[model samples]
Target chain A: MEFEMKIDYYSGDPGEFIKVIEEKCTGCGQCAKFCTRDVWEADGKIYRPINLKDCVECGACWNICTADAIIFGDPKGGTGVRFTHG
Target chain B: MTEDNFFDVIVVGAGCAGPAAAKKTAELGLKTLLIEKSPEPGTKTISGTCINLAGMHNEDLYYILKGPIEREIHSMRTYHINDARTTVFNEIPTKGVLLLSIRRDIFDAWHTEQAKLAGAEVKLSTTVTDIIEENDYVCGVITDSGEEFRCKVLIDAAGVNSIVGRNAGLIPKRSGDNMILYVTVAVELGEEVINDRFSDEQGGYCIEYYLAPGIQYKTWPWIFPKKDTVTLGTGGYMTKDLFNDKITNVNQYMQNFLNLPIVKRKLEGGKIVSWGLHLEYDEKISQKVKNGLILTGEAGGFVIPFLGEGMSPAFATGIFAAKTAAEAIQKNNFSKESMSSMYEDMIEEDLFLQGFMHVGKINKESILKKSEEEISNMMQSVVLGGGFITNAVHTKWLEGAENGDIEKVQEALDFLEFIQPYRQIGSEFEEIYRKLRAEGGS
Candidate 1:
C-alpha cells in the first residue's frame, strides 16, 4: 500500500541552515535517524538533506554526526519556523 | 571591525543562559553584548514546555515574568507500562519545591527584555560563525555577517550545539551514548477541554510520565498539561543499536508514543499546534572554563541526567557565569588562572557538588537485581524524593534500621548526615533518622 506523507507542521523555509559535507559523511545514517523532520534521507549510501524546507534547525543532526560532516546554523531572520505556543 | 569593536564581555546565543549572563555582566558596569542566531529568543529553542521555577522564585527575572506561568504542577503521576500500574507524588509545601508549567516563548522573550533593560546590547539574527583567538586565548567571536567583535571574556551559552565552545576547543565532543534525542508536540485543546481532561484545578495540573520498557530501552514518555495545550514527548539515549532496533527515526517513536491507548484517549480531538526535535547531553561538568572563555547551561552539560530538566540549571549557571565574569572584569584579569578559579569556585559551590550527589547512573546490572514491582516503586520514590540518591538513602536507612544491620544502618546514616545540609530532603531525612535512633535496635 502506498500512502502520502503528512506535511510538516512547522512553517517557513530553513534556507541553507543545515550543510552536509559529503566528503566527511560516512553513510552512517545517524543524522536521518536522529532528525524528527524528514530533512535527511539515506539512499543506501550517504545521507542528504533532502527536505531542507522542513528543517526546524534543531541541530540534532549536526550533534549526532560523529564525523563532523554537518554544519547547522539558524535560518535568516523571519525565515524559519516560528512557534506560536512554545 | 578593529579592536575598537570590543566589549568587556560577549555572550553568544540568547537562550536561557546567555541573556542571564549578559544582564549580570552589564549590571556590574561591564560592556556586554548578547547575540542570538534566531530572529527572536525561543523561536528555535525546544523545551518540554514545562519549567520547574522553584529555585528562581526570588530572582528579579522570575519576578518580572511570573505572570506567564500557566499552572503550578502540584503532583506528578507515573504509569508503569509493563504492569499498567500508576503512582502519584503530591507536592509538600515544607519540601520547598514545585514545578511551574510555562510557555518558553513568553519566558525567553521576557528574559531578553530584562537583559536589554539592564543595558546589555542584544543583537537578534546574529549568528556567531567562529571563535576568534589571540595567543591561544579565545578573545572574541566572528559573526556570520563577517563582523568581528572582540571581548575580554567570551561566554558560550549556545546550548547543546555549543558552537563557540566547541570551535574554541574548550568543550569536548559528546558521543551518542551521552546524547538524548527527544521530540515534543504541542496539542491545542482550549482551556475547558484541558481542565476537564486533565482535571486542572488551582495548583492541580498533573504531569504524567510513562515507562514503556518493551518499546524502547531506558526511555520514557511524558504528557504535560499547559494552559491551553498538552505537550507529548519522549526521549532515549542516542545509540546506534537502540536506533536500529526500535527508534529507526524519531518520528516513528513519536507515532508510537501517540498510539498508546492513554495518550490517544486524552488527545483524541486535540490538534497538534507545534512539534520539534531537541538534543540533550548528559555528561557531567568538565573543562567548562579556560583563559578567556566560559561555558554555561547545556553548552556546559548542565541538564539533569535522569529527568532531562535543563531550564533551572541553565538559569542557575547563567547567573553564576555572569557573577564570575563580573569578578574577573573588575580585577582586570582575563588570565586562565584567575578566571578559572572564579568560575570553578562558583560552579563547585552552587552546581557541581550538588549535581554529583544525584548522578542517577542507571545500568542493566542494577535493574536485574530488582523485581519489576520493586523497580516501579523505586522509580516513584526517586521522583517523589527529588532524585535517586535521596531515595536510596531513605530506603537504605529505613531498611537497615528495621533489619538491625548495624553496619548498613551506620553507613546510610553517615551518608544522610553528610548530604543533609546541601540537599532539600533534610527534614524528611531527619524524621527517618530520629525514628531509627529512637527504635535503638541497631
Candidate 2:
C-alpha cells in the first residue's frame, strides 16, 4: 500500500500556531531537515513553518531547532490535524 | 480566576493520564476539571497500540481491561532481519492475555466519558495556553479563550510536548539520547483480513517487533492489529545519525519497513488509512512537581514507548498523582516536598513499573551497542538455548566477563534474580484477573 504521506486534518483554521523568530533562526535549517510533514520551508536566510496547517503537533521541528527560533505553541483548540486510528 | 472557574483539582490533556487523574480525583470528592485540546480525546494521539497486562494487575486499573478492547493479545513475534536471513521468534501462546490491542481514539474517548460519569467536568477543544504561576506556586491555568481556571493543585497530564510542563520550567527542550521521534501508519485491512493475517486464534491477537538496520535506529519497529486496521511504526532516537544518508527521514524508515518482503506480504491488499507522528521522552524528568502542581504521564516522563508502555504508566502515575493531590489537600500543604514524598514513594514501590523500566533500559542499551549482524547472532543464541529474558542477561554477563567487570556481572545476576518471578507471572495474574472480574468493575 502506498500511503504517499497522506494525513487527515480538521476542517477549521488553527490560526498562526507556529512562527519563526527570524533573528534567531541562523539559517541552520535543522527544522526543515527533520520535519516529516514538510511543515518548514527555507526562505533565504531562515526556515518558516509555512505549512503549519498540516502540522501534526509532534514538536519535532521545535525540539530539534537548536537556536530556539521556532516559536512553537498550540493552534486554537479542535482546529488542527485530526489523526485517525491512533 | 473567577469563582465558577475554580476547582479543587484541575487536570490538563485528556489523553491516557488526564482522564484517569480527573476521574480518580472527582471520585475522591474533589471538584475536578479536565481540559483537552483536541475536539475528541485520543484523536490526536498515536502509538504501537498494545496495553501491557502488567499494568492492569492493580485493582485501581482493572477497569481499563473492561474498555473497548480490539483484541486480547497472548503472543508476541519478533522479526530479526539481516542480509543473511530472517530470524522470526514466535512466542508460544500463553493461557492468559499478555496484553490488549486498542484504538486510541476509541479507548481515550471512552476513558474520558468515564471521567465525566465520575463527576469530572470536562472541557473539550480547550487548550491550556498559559500556566498561572504565582510566586512559584502553580495557582491556575489560562485557556486559548483566555479563560482562567484556578485550582488548589494542578495535574499536568498534557503529554510529552506539554505546554503546562514546559511553561512550568520542568520539561526542558531535549533531543538526541533521551528523546524518541517515531512515525506510524494504519492500514485498512478490515477485521477479517487482520484476523486472518495476524492469526488471532483462540481470541488472542499477536504483536510483531522488527529489528533491521535500515528500518530503525536503536529501537524496534512494530506491527499491531486493531479491529479494521493494522498499525505499523518505525523510528528511533533523535540522534545526529538518525537522519543519515541511508535513511534521510522517518518516512524512509517506514517505507523501508513496508518494503521488507515479510512485511510487504502481510500488508498486501491493505489500504493506508491514517498516519501518525509522535515524540516521547525516554528518561524520567528530575522535577515532576512544584508547589501546588504535579506532573504525571508523559509530562513526568514515565513512558517507555518501545514497550508500548506509556499508556499504562500514564494511568498508573495519573492515579498516584490524584492520590497525592488528595493527600496534599487533606494536609493543606501544596509544597513539592509533600507531593513528591507521597507520589515518588509509591512510584518507588511499584515493582512492575521498576522491572519493565530496567528491562527496557538494559535491552535498548545492549541491543544498540552491537552491530546488526551481532544482534542476529545474539538472537539466534536466544532461540537455541535460553529464551528472551535469559538472552538479555546472558549478553550483559558476556560483556561484563569480557571487560573483567565483576560489578557488572553481579548487577546482571541481580537483575536476573529480580526478573525471575516476573517470567511466570502469567498464571498468577490470570487468577487475579478472574478474581477481580468476578468481584466488581471489570
Candidate 3:
C-alpha cells in the first residue's frame, strides 16, 4: 500500500523546517531531483545538505524523499494548491 | 419500453476529465450521471509529473482543487548529461498561472465530491461494458452486471485504455509504438533533512531531465514534490513486441539511476517505498466526438507528445466537454457534427495541444536521428531561441540554419509567433535551454 502525507513548508521556524533521520536516510537522491533549493548533494552515495539555511520550506523535497528520512513541523495556517479553476 | 430514466448527460470515468465535465454539467442544472469503474474515485488514476494551470477557469477550478492539491509549481529546472551544468527559468504565458502537484487518488476523490455537491450522481466501483446505439447515434450504455442506463449524451473519459471509444467505432485500434509506459516510486524524507538539502530554490517545485543515452524511446524522468511525498518516474516509447512484454526488472534501472553522478550526488541517502504505473496514449486523437458519444483526456489522445504531460489538458477538456454537452442537451442535439465542434474548439484553445501538434510530428526524427553532440547543439538552440514552445517552434529555423541566410534577430521574432499564446513563457524555455547547454559544455 502507498503511504501518503502532506506537510507545510511555511510552518514553524525556518531554521528547524528540516528534520533528518540519519538511519532512515539511505542517500538514494530521489529527493534531490524534486528539490529546487539544491539542498542535498551526494557525498559517496549518501546525501547531505550542501547548506541547510537556504530552504524555501516548500516541503516538496520532504514529501518525495523516500526511506521516511525527511519530516516537517506543525501544520501551516492555510490550504495548499490554491487553484484559479480546474 | 420501460419508463426511461433519462439524465441530460452521462459521463463515464470519474478521473480528471469526467469530473470536470460532471461538475460543469451539474452546475448548469443538466441532469448528470458520473460513472466510475474504480472501487473509489481516482483509485485507478495515474497522472504524469506536473499539471500546468494553463487553461484553468478560475472560479470553478479554485472550488474543486483547493483541498486536494499538494503544492503549486512556480518554477522549473532542466538538466543535461553534464554534471557541471543546468538550466532554470521563471517565466510563462501568465504570472498567475500555476500548476498543482496532486495525488491522483486524493484529487479524483475530491473532484467526485465536488461534482456530487453540484448535484451530479456518482456511480463508483461500477463498470460500463457497452454503448447502445441506434441509427449511428448513441442512446445509452450497459454495465457488466446486466444493468442498463440510458442517456441523451455519453462521454468517454476512460483514459489511454479507453474501451468506449473503440467499441463505439469512434477510433481504430492503436499500435505499440504509440504507447508509453511509466513506473513511479513515491519516496518520503524528513523536513529538516530536506530543508538543509535544497535551500537554494524559491518555492518547493519540481524538476525534469533528458539524461544521457537519450533516444527516441528514452523519454525524460520527472521529480514531482507534493505535500509530504515526492513522485518520481521515467517513461519511453515502445514497439508492439516490447510493449506487450512484462517489465523485466525496474529495480535494476532504478539502481543504475541511483549511481548516476547527479542522482548519487543529490539523493545519496534517499529511499523508495511504493511503485505505480502510468499508461501512455497509444494513438493521436483525430476525432473526439460522435453522434452520441465524446472522448476526453488520454481517451482522446491529448497527451503532450514531447513532454508527455496531459493533466492540464485533461482537466480543461473535462470542463469544455461538460459545457458542450449541456448546450447540446438544451438544443436537443447530440449529432456527431455538433459534438465534433467541441473537440475542435478545445484542441484549438489548448496550448499543450497546439505546441504538441505543431512540433509532435518531428519528435521521432529529432530524438532518433541525432547523436549526443547534435542533440546538445539542438538543445542550445532551444535555450537561446527563448521559451519552451518558442524554442521548439524555432526548430524549423535550425533546419534552415544549414543555409546560413536566416537573420539571427528575426529567428527570435519568428520563434515568438510560433509560441502564440505561450509567448510569455519564452524566457522560461530560454533559461532551461541555457542551463542544458551549460551542462553540456561543462
Candidate 4:
C-alpha cells in the first residue's frame, strides 16, 4: 500500500495546530525541506502549514525550522493523526 | 480551581513514562492523575515496538514485564552489506529472552491500566494545552477542555516535541546531529507466516538489523516482528546530509530497504498495514526539573534511539521522578535545588540506566567518527570482539597505545572499568525474569 493510505486520523478539524510565525520565518525552507508530508508551503516570504490535515503530528517541520517559525501544538483532544501500534 | 481538580501528582502524556510515574506515585498513596491527549492512551504514538529486558532489571520495574506483550526475542541477525559481500551474524545471545516484542498501543494501554488499577485517576482524551504556574513553579496544567487541574508536582512525559517542555523553555530547537527522524512501516503477514519466517525452535524470535550505504545513514535499520505484523524502520539523524541523490526522502530509503533481496523475500506476501513518522532526541536536556515540575521520558531527553533502548530509561526516570516528587512533598519543599538534585541523584544512582546511557554515548561517538563503509568493514571483524562498545574501546585503547597517548588509553580503561559490571548483567536479569515468571507473571 502507499505510504499515504496506511495512515489514519480522527474525523474533525484539528484547529490551527501548526502555524508559521511569519516574522520569524527566514524562508530558508528548512521546515518544508524536513517535512515528509509536504504540509508546509511557501507563501510569499514565509511558509504556512497549508496541508495541515496530511500532518502525522511528527513535529519534524517544527524541530527543523531553523528560524523558529513553526508553532507546533497538539490537536484537539482525540482528534489528530492516529497511528496503530508499531 | 475546585478542590476536586487538585491532585498530589499529575502526570501528562500517558505514554511509556507517564503511566509508570503515575503508578509509582499512586502506589505511594499520593492522589495522582494521569492525562493523555488520545482517546486511547497509546494509539497516537509510534515506536520501534520492542523493550529490552536487560534494561528493566530494577525490582520496581519488574511489574512492567507483566503487561501485554507479543513475542519473546532471543536472537538478533545483523546484516553488514558491503560492495564485496554481505556478512550475516545470527547471534543467539542466550536461552532466555533478551527483548520483548510489543504493540505500543496495547502495551501502553495496559501500562496505563496498571496505573489506574494502582489508584491513579486517569483522564483520557485530554490535552494539556498550557501549564499553570504559581511563583515561578509549574504547579498545575490547563487542558484543551478549558478546565484547569492543579497539582503539587507535574510530571512531563509528553514525548520529543512536547509542548509542555517547550513552553517551559527547556526543549530547544533541535535538528542536525542530535535529532533523529525515523520512519517506520508495519506489514501484515498473518501469524503463521510470521512464525514461519521469523521464529526459531528455541521459542524465540529474531530482530534483523541492516547496515549499508543507501539503506541508512550510519544508523542501523531494524525489522522487528510482532504477532502478525513485521515493523521495519530506517532513517537517519536530521542533518543536512539526510537526503541525497539516491534517497530524496525517508520513504526512498524505506523503498531501498524493502528492495533488499533478503527483506523482499521475507515480506513477499505482506501488505503495509501501518506507517509512522517518529523523532528521537538523542542528547539529554540541560535541565529536567524546575520548582514543581519534572520532565521524564523523551520530554526529558531520556531516549537513546540509535541504540534502540528507551523504554527502560523512560520507566526508570518516570519512577525516579515520582519518588523525587513524593520526597519533595514529604519535606514540603519543591525548590529546584532540592527536587532537581534529588531527581538527578536518583537517575545517576541507577547503574542500569547510567550504564546504558554511557554505552550509547561511547558507541554514538565512535560510530559518528567513522564512515559507514568503515564501520561495515569493522563490524565484519568487530562482532567477534562483542559489539560496538567493545570495538570502540579496543580500537581506542590500541590506538592510544600505538600513539603513546597515555591519557587516551587511561580514558578507555576507565570506561571499561565502569562498564565492566554492566557487561555481565544480562544473566542476572534473566535469572530475575525467570523467578518473576515462575512467581506468576504474563
Q: Pick the candidate with the highest TM-score.
A: 4
lDDT of 3 by residue, B47-85 (tens): 544556553433444444454566656555555565456
Summed over model 3, clashes come to 54
The CA lDDT of each predicted structure is 0.70, 0.85, 0.60, 0.86
Could you tell which candidate, 3 or 4, scores higher by TM-score?
4
CAPRI docking class of candidate 4: medium
As a TM-score, model 1 comes out at 0.83
For candidate 3, report its TM-score. Answer: 0.70
At residue B290, what lDDT does model 2 achieve? 93
The sequence of per-residue lDDT tens digits that candidate 2 reaches over residues B167-229 is: 999988988878888999999888898888887456567888888879887777899888899
TM-score of each: 0.83, 0.95, 0.70, 0.96
The CA lDDT at B173 in model 3 is 43
Off by over 4 Å in 4: A1-5, B201-203, B426-428, B438-442
Binned by DockQ into CAPRI classes (incorrect, acceptable, medium, high), candidate 3 is incorrect
lDDT tens digits, residue span B273-358, model 4: 88998898899899899889999999999988767888889998999999999999999999889999999998887877777676
Which 10-residue span in candidate 4 chain B carries the lowest summed lDDT?
A: B375-384
Give the higher-DockQ candidate: 2 or 4.
Answer: 2
User: Residue B224 of candidate 4: its Cα lDDT?
Assistant: 94
DockQ of each: 0.38, 0.75, 0.02, 0.66
| Every candidate's TM-score, chain A alone | 0.79, 0.91, 0.59, 0.89
